[model samples]
Target: MTTMFRKALNALPRLGVQVVDLGPGAAVISRRGRYSATKVSADAWMVGGGRRSTRAPAEGWGLRKAAASSLCARHVADFLANYEVNCVFDVGANRGQYGRQLRESGYRGRIVSFEPVPDALARLRKAAERDPDWWVRPVALGRSESVQSMHLGWKTMNSLLEPSAYGQQRYKRFADTRTTQVQVRRLDKVMDEALHGIANPRPFLKMDTQGFDMEVFAGAGERLDEYVGMQSEVAALQLYEGSPHMTEALAAYEEAGFGITGLYPVTREETTGRVVEFDCVLARVSSVPGSAAGVRP
Candidate 1:
């Protein structure tokens, strides 16, 4: 099919045509016009040009949004609405997937996304280009500040920790062990700068740093209390060496006064159908400085 499309493109008149590869799921070629490519499913692409519909085709981040809205977006939306969240610190925001889902869920608050991978960061920046409230930081948040080697995994599965042997076998597609050095910072150190001009910053944290969610949370230090709600990826089976277990991470959050709001499965073991990880949503019900006092609706 791609060959036929290329042949057709070659036969077209050189009428100042331009082509843009809109990431893995879509591509667009136009001559003073616009086109859209929607990923209807994992292996399908639907391309269209100029259209108006009550429900537009999912493209790029919209594809991710559609996929997430079906799973955890509703819960996340309720978290934001319930807590009156004003800003979101999207830790490990690969290509702004979480941010896009936030927008899709009708949360128009500020989004500060942090990512380290070069290619993913490029796509993430592009996705946030037009949104003044969406900010992208090309750095990984961790327990400390330093330059660390990030283990490259499949898609958004890259991590600061090495992949475990069982993890490698269980997720063969994520077994690529390439490494890239990226800047790592403690969130507390950069918090002021990231939220400089934002007023009444009732922050919500959506952490999906592969298996390093706890480290990112640890990096928040005393500033951790500034967030009203959080979503962390908890691994039931260790996917990354040195990653905290599900119980340990959950206990830590509970110890920090966060109560469970929801637990959404992220992946399941194929053979046993057992959950491998979960998107653990938690909220602080107590009145805090970041929420319930002058926070915007």
Candidate 2:
């Protein structure tokens, strides 16, 4: 696609299309041909204000909401740049999508991804083979170092825990999933081995491990203070067994020396207006004291 077409497509939400982001600054702006797009280069807010016509939707509901989502995503991407990120731990990195998205968002640092799904591992290894800074590990992260059964979803929804009925009711793609055993390890042990002798590595940890976000953190507590920023996908309801939901997840992060500074909706239920999950960005409270990003006591 041409540059001008891409810019025009960024104004799609203004045209009443319910465009949703697949990742930071990436959107499915096409309705005519379903030509999905990664819209990170240009500012959607600027394009909407000047180019996209408001003559279409009087409420501007789609434009307002979708633009916020895209912009919030962009904000998270920008926020990461505040720190000199030595590496981004892309946990639950299925097919290296997050790593690819980070690079497209102008993050030129090293990306260390960990994946254990057999099919995803194959694709992930091949995908990151060309980028020297993008590294992949064939391992799963959990509370302990052992073998655990991973419930397989059709796509990126796979998890170490079994899906709850509520999650299945909202989305069946992960329901009645097949399980496969995979090697699991703790983050503290893995990080020490992975980044040995790499002095002063200010890592940024991001997790999309379905419902195992808290457990992933539980395993990384020793190194939690070392990361510059951390982001996790949080569920509103119990989607998996004993996984931390919205309130509990927030408290957990607070106790971990991080402050909840950003919340971007990742999934929502259209029928009952329930938020399935969201990407919560947390910065160390003491790291940036008195700044807006710091979690207020």
User: In model 1, which residue pairs have backbone atoms overlapping below 3 Å?
Assistant: none
lDDT of 1 by residue, 1-297 (tens): 567666555555465675655554445777755556555444545555554444543343334344443546777887798777888999998988888878978999889999999999999999999999999999999999999998875787888888888788887866557888999999899889878787767888889998899999999999988878899999999998999999999999999989998886777664465778888889887733455653434
Give candidate 2 misplaced runs (Cα > 4 Å).
Answer: 1-42, 45-69, 289-297
Q: What is the lDDT of every predicted structure here? A: 0.80, 0.75
Candidate with maximal lDDT: 1
Best by TM-score: 2
User: How many Å off is the CA of 130 in candidate 2?
Assistant: 0.7
TM-score, each model?
Answer: 0.74, 0.76
Q: Which ten residues in a row have the lowest lDDT in candidate 1?
A: 57-66
Error of 2 at 89 (Å): 0.7
